[model samples]
Target: MSSLYGLRPLPSHGRFGYSAITRRPGYAWPNGARLAVYLGFNLEHFAFGEGLGARIGPASPEPDVLNYSWREYGNRVGAWRCLELFDQLALPTGCLLNTALYDHCPELVSAFAARGDELIGHGHTNAERQGDMPEAQELALLAGCHARIAQESGTAPRGWLSPWISESRTTPDLLAETGYDYTLNWAHDDQPLP
Candidate 1:
């Protein structure tokens, strides 16, 4: 295919080549189940005023209390409620966590860990985008997150999901070098890619 940007070639992550699903061989879920479902519960933290966040209303000046409190509500109340529901349902969950939670609410992270949920690395905070960092800084971010999660959660994460689903061109390469087995950043295919 022609390069979308003409002279400037499209950046490639080099993780996997495109393959049509119809041309691929069939695969079955465990016990021949037709489908599978699991909860990807995001437990994130953000800087109080000066970082990226999903605004409920129009953007305001520093210390966006309205949006900050809105997100904080998840950690303070919504997460506990959801935990109760998950317990009642007896469901397995994959907790995509920001390492900042260790500092913000260690108890909450522990609750999920106690329930045997898979803890996946989700950067230090959603306030910053990984794609914007220089390669060295990005590497440090990935390594720091990995080390922190492993130390706090008692197990290193095997998967990753960059905050805001943002990624630099070398993100997959960095993930592999940082010992991640998979990433949630790419969701174009129904099946996992190599």
Candidate 2:
């Protein structure tokens, strides 16, 4: 049986003696079999010592906000390593990009865009919470994210995947109003209900 984190059990059979066994989200169920493949990647890293981060704006994301470095990580190098690995594999991935990432690494964004990779908004930065921020601030920052996306990818985003899955009550409604196609801030269900 397919599972994530190797702990959560699969769902049981529902009504009519049927169980959905989906492998990934947005996939077609074959004869009530739930199976799908996910194409996703999270791109995050810091350039400085990995502490205070860029510390530019009032809402700049924290670069770990703790130590300069740690086990199994490097400052500003993780993304490049991942990029190289993905490029070598010729794999397509969806980048849940923090706008700060774009502002910080335009070249990296270009690399992904060149591969036709999907870039979903991950807030203007990875620090302040879009779901927690005031609505006005959120909207303004979202607009800024699109502007930067265009600047980096040469196109505006059609989706939003908030950082850390920072979902709010109004996130769906707001994204709908903003003309987004979908969101990736909820539990991953194999069935495409929404």
Candidate 3:
């Protein structure tokens, strides 16, 4: 009887099964804190005009410099400023990182790693959606992201956030099989769920 009209049906016997919010037992966060706040600091890279991206203006022809440059600025300047602010506030962030960011700007990624932030895999790029890829291709994509981030960051990430929040039917299976501890694709929960 559980359903959300447009979404695919919840998987059977999945890692976390369906239960009414009211029926679940009360939970307390670590340190008995009533609330937990973690920043999702996204550092992404994008392919030019070939895949999905945000734009500062209306879409133009190929090689959309307007939009591409806008996104690039985040890596070049904005993210660094944000990191400084986070440091000033003495906050720890959960870095949502695209593997492509390592290729595009390794130093920037290093800045976050050096700050003791937790790097969460965010795929290779936001240019393409993973949801429509074939099963094998999707698996490779997942593995590639994990490998590249591990190689560059010196530690494999334990969490994932699909590129553009895109995912295939088997994304969860891929995550579990490939050694990721959790994913951010599910947005309904305020707390991490098993």
Candidate 4:
């Protein structure tokens, strides 16, 4: 084993373009301030039917559910509840969205857009996890996710988190190629890392 272990050198010069607004130092949460609360939804509740066949099949739970009402419930009840809370607090909230939500409830998607809320894609489907697929498949899936989310959400996704916290060896490169501005999958630092 080498004495250097796994340590790698970091750039010693030049500034990384960044800033903070409505914030103070030593907080450095983002934009130089502490985040009061970050609201995120896996957004997969829509695909509960396809992902969890029980939600739709004969083996379905005794919920007497509609064809695919999970997202509708999420948007109408869950999202709205969250929005109302934020409104009461006048707080800035973030949303973690999944691609499938667009298909399930376009109006809900529009609501988020209308509010100008922060959004980041969680993935195409709640259960179509990425970390287990082959590199090529992962990349293709990532590309498809980006396109679908943009088509439905009315904006190109700037970041991605993942369904079920899943990822493959190639997730990084694939995410980069998919035109993401950043990712929150491998968080392990006091500050955000690329």
Candidate 5:
């Protein structure tokens, strides 16, 4: 037992070691403003009769048409309306894109690209999660997403937000290898941390 049991420091983990924000160097944001804003608009697709999804009603056993159709509405109609609103407000957005949207309804994706919004990788689809995949499979998913976004959007995505904010142990390493410069998975604070 130590003299001050309650004051012992905990061991640090992860590649980013612990450091208090107050002790770190301070810098002003662009235009000398302390805040900046960007919208994270998610455009996703789901597999029918399988995997995970958000629901507007109680869970059905399987092949839930009500829920599936509800989600599909966002792609077919809702996203367009939202885009129009963004344009009216003259705001920039960062789309957390599911690559499946490229095949399912490319026009929707093209609309975002036309507005010069940033496309951030959000996997091939939201039906499954990257955290559940093995390392090799996760890497493949990351690489596939990078390539798809670059080909379809014309500008390659500089960041990623794992489907459902899910990731395997090697996600960071894999993201770097696949050319991602940032991630939205962690939001512990207003400022971006290493």
Candidate 6:
């Protein structure tokens, strides 16, 4: 297909075969409910002054305490408050976790686990992007995260959400090979895709 500018369309991610939403058969939700809601809470950790993170101000040199601390505030304070609210509301939460939290603040992860929240793998830390790694390295990373989460949480995560939502060409295949049942990498539709 060609664009208005006469440029060829970009290649597709071949794994996701197309199926127009309107043409696809409808399915009922669990408990015959008309709606479904899930809270995806992220709990990530970043290296000090090294690697990617959301910056609030202009970039600075190494040891960027300003940006590092800004992101840190989430794990330090924000997450706790959010946890309290979730508990009070009796909400079920799926926590996309960075395994590094095991070193930084294990209590936080334990608190969520104690509440019977679902823990999903989200890489070791947000400091690095999985998309940039070589295939073997990415596989190792995925497998390691799976093992760690299973060991810590007492169950393997059935889902994954890459750091920064980044993925290499082989991510989906790797996810399947490594035993992940689903991923949050794609957002082309409101409903889940095969």
Q: Please report, in order, the local distance difference test score of every candidate based on alpha carbons.
A: 0.92, 0.65, 0.87, 0.67, 0.90, 0.92
The residue-level lDDT of candidate 6 at 20 comes to 85
Off by over 4 Å in 1: 1-13
Question: Which residue pairs collide, candidate 2?
Answer: 21-34, 22-34, 22-35, 23-35
Those runs of model 5 whose alpha carbons end farther than 4 Å from true positions after fitting are 1-13
Q: What is the C-alpha RMSD of each candidate to the true structure, in Å?
A: 2.7, 9.7, 3.8, 7.3, 2.4, 2.2
Each model's total of backbone clashes: 0, 4, 0, 3, 0, 0
Give the true-structure RMSD of model 6: 2.2
Please give each candidate's TM-score: 0.92, 0.66, 0.89, 0.68, 0.91, 0.93
RMSD of 2: 9.7
Q: Better model by lDDT, 2 or 6?
A: 6
Per-residue accuracy of model 6 over 1-194 as CA lDDT, tens digit each: 45777898578877777778899788678899888897999999999978988789888897888889988999999999999999899998999999999999999999999999999999999999999999999999999999999999899999999999999999999999998999988877867777
**Cα error, candidate 2, residue 188 (Å):** 4.2
Model 3 lDDT per residue over 44-119, tens place: 8999768889777888788888889999999999999998899999999999988887778999999999998999
| Ordering by lDDT | 6, 1, 5, 3, 4, 2
* lDDT score at residue 139, model 2, on the 0-100 scale: 69
Clash pairs detected, candidate 6: none
Model 1, position 81, has a per-residue lDDT of: 98
Error of 2 at 80 (Å): 1.9
Leading candidate by TM-score: 6
* Winner on TM-score (2 vs 4): 4
Error of 2 at 25 (Å): 15
Q: Per-residue lDDT of 16-60 in model 4, one digit per residue for the tens? A: 343453353454555766664556544454444455322443444
